[model samples]
Target: MADIGGKRVAILATNGFEQSELEVPRDKLREAGAEVHVISLESGEIKGWDLKDWGRTVPVDRVLSDVSADDYDALVLPGGQINPDILRAEPAAIDFIKAFWADKKVIGAICHAPWLLVEAGIIEGRKVTSYHSIKTDVVNAGGKWEDSEVVTDQGLVTSRKPDDLPAFCAKVVEEIGEGRHERRAA
Candidate 1:
């Protein structure tokens, strides 16, 4: 697999982000030389939810309102039901994600994270995967929802859940390392 080698990746997450979904990929991406930045709606720290209880707190590097999609090579959305749900309701958060699609940057979403995609109105006409519960939402939003553990459609890559993290991270790193292309930017 190719290394990201200093590629800047943005992870848009907030309180209630699934612990593994956020930490695993972030760690792997950084290990491969990607500069991972956690941007959230909060100013200080964001809490993570382990399967049943509170897990840990990660410092928020930037606020959603401060990010420009053009400054990143890729975008990551870590799912936890609450995280994306809250984000989907935030205008700035949705706009930040919309800018990523407009710029054609690699967009990686896991579990229920794609809810933000549906809210941003960018999944239509594309194939994607997410936590099975929201499969209908993807379809309803005009996206071709799939049952696969991972799906990579165009510049967008998605996965089912924490179990899919390995493949998800691998695909995300691949997308980021591929470099930007005009087709994605348009």
Candidate 2:
């Protein structure tokens, strides 16, 4: 793992986030020396959805109202059917994601998490991959969706599912280490 010793990464998620998707990359990033924070709709804790049922709870480090894209070096979006669906509907969350995209900061999204990216209007013309169920949504949003284990476009990193966590986390660390990327003019 690369040493991101002073970098700060924000995981934007809410209740019902996929358990593994949220935890795996977070633990991996933390182990690589990056400061990781869980930012959500509120303070206190948010629960995870483990496949069929509710999973463990993670403490909220900061609330969406209190943090901005400038607060971190990279932004992570963890996917769960419920998590992204709720987040995509929240204007604050969508705006926060848009700010990160506009700044060319590293943005990592997995599974259904890309829904937020689609909602943020940053997916058009970008190459990405996500859980199969949302393939149509990504394509409909103008993104070139692939079936690969992981895909990286500019500073954006995305993966297909929870099983792709190892590859996803590695690419995220690599991209964050590379810092901001320049997106070609549309």
Candidate 3:
């Protein structure tokens, strides 16, 4: 467990997020001493998608228009079929993710959430992993897709699925500890 005390992390999510993907990382990161906030397209709360059904709702800590990459040390993107699909269509959401990359802040995307990465145009030429179903999307986006529990390229971290959340969250904390990375080549 890395001591990320006082570090600020943002978990970008929306309705239909994979239940565990959002909760596990958020809880674990908080337990590791980082201040974690849930940022979404709207205020109030967002519903989650459990393995086979709609799961619990998580309260939003901040709205997308209210924050930026400069407000946090790291950013997290949790995936679900519906969540990323919807978020990827939002220009503001994509720009938020891009800002994190421009600043070289730690960015973590798992499962279908990599779709947001593809939309943000940050995964190109970077090594990453996501739920197997989204492998082609990642590769097509020019990312070096890997079949691994977790992959880290520069300060960007990615994982395959809920089963990989443990490694993903751990690496996120580690990357936050390392601070920002250098910009990637165009």
Candidate 4:
């Protein structure tokens, strides 16, 4: 496990995020010694979507307007049908993602979270994976879609679903430890 002590990681999410996807990674990163922040569109807490119904709410560490991409070493996007859909439509969210890509900072998107990457226009020619239903969206956006538990292209880490959370979280830590990548800037 990478002991990324003092490293700052931001988890970009809003209401409707998959419960396990966000919580697990956030916890794992924190345990690995990274300072993790839950950033959202609003200042208040956001509710999460469990397997079926709404789950617990996660308090927001900071709002989108208050955060700068350069403050964090890695950006994590947790997926749920509603979560990514809302984020993809938000210009601020897309801009942050683009900033991370431009800096070659670590970016992890699991499940439907890859939608944000597609909207940011950074996944062109990048290999990625997501929830099975969004495979077409990834492909159409110029990403080489793969069916796997986890896929890491450059500093980008993606996974298929909640079942793949273990692998996804590990890859996020590994990428964070490696620091910025030398991938082509967006």
- Estimate, for each residue in 60-87, the C-alpha lDDT of model 1 and write its tens digit: 9998777799889999999998899999
- What would the TM-scores of all predictions be? 0.95, 0.99, 0.98, 0.98
Taking the tens digit of each residue's C-alpha lDDT, what string does model 3 give over 1-186? 899999999999999999999999999999999999999999999999999999999999999999988899999999999999999999999999999998889999989998999999888899999999989988999999999999999998999999898989889999999998986584
Stretch of 10 with least lDDT, candidate 4: 177-186
Candidate 2: where are CA atoms >4 Å away? none
Q: Candidate 4, residues 1-186: lDDT per residue as tens digits?
A: 789999999999999999999999999999999999999999989999998999999999999999989999999999999999999999999999999988889999999999999999998899899999999999999999999999999999999999999989989999999999998543
Best by TM-score: 2
Which prediction has more favorable lDDT, 3 or 4?
A: 4
Better of 1 and 4 by lDDT: 4
Candidate 3, residue 172: lDDT:
92
Model 2 poorest ten-residue lDDT run: 177-186
In the range 1-186, model 2's lDDT, one tens digit per residue, is: 888999999999999999999999999999999999999999999999999999999999999999999999999999999999999999999999999999999999999999999999999999999999999999999999999999999998999999999999999999999999999953
Answer with 2 or 4, whichever has the higher TM-score: 2
lDDT of 3 at 64: 98
In model 1, the runs with Cα more than 4 Å from the true position are 181-186
Top of the candidates by lDDT: 2
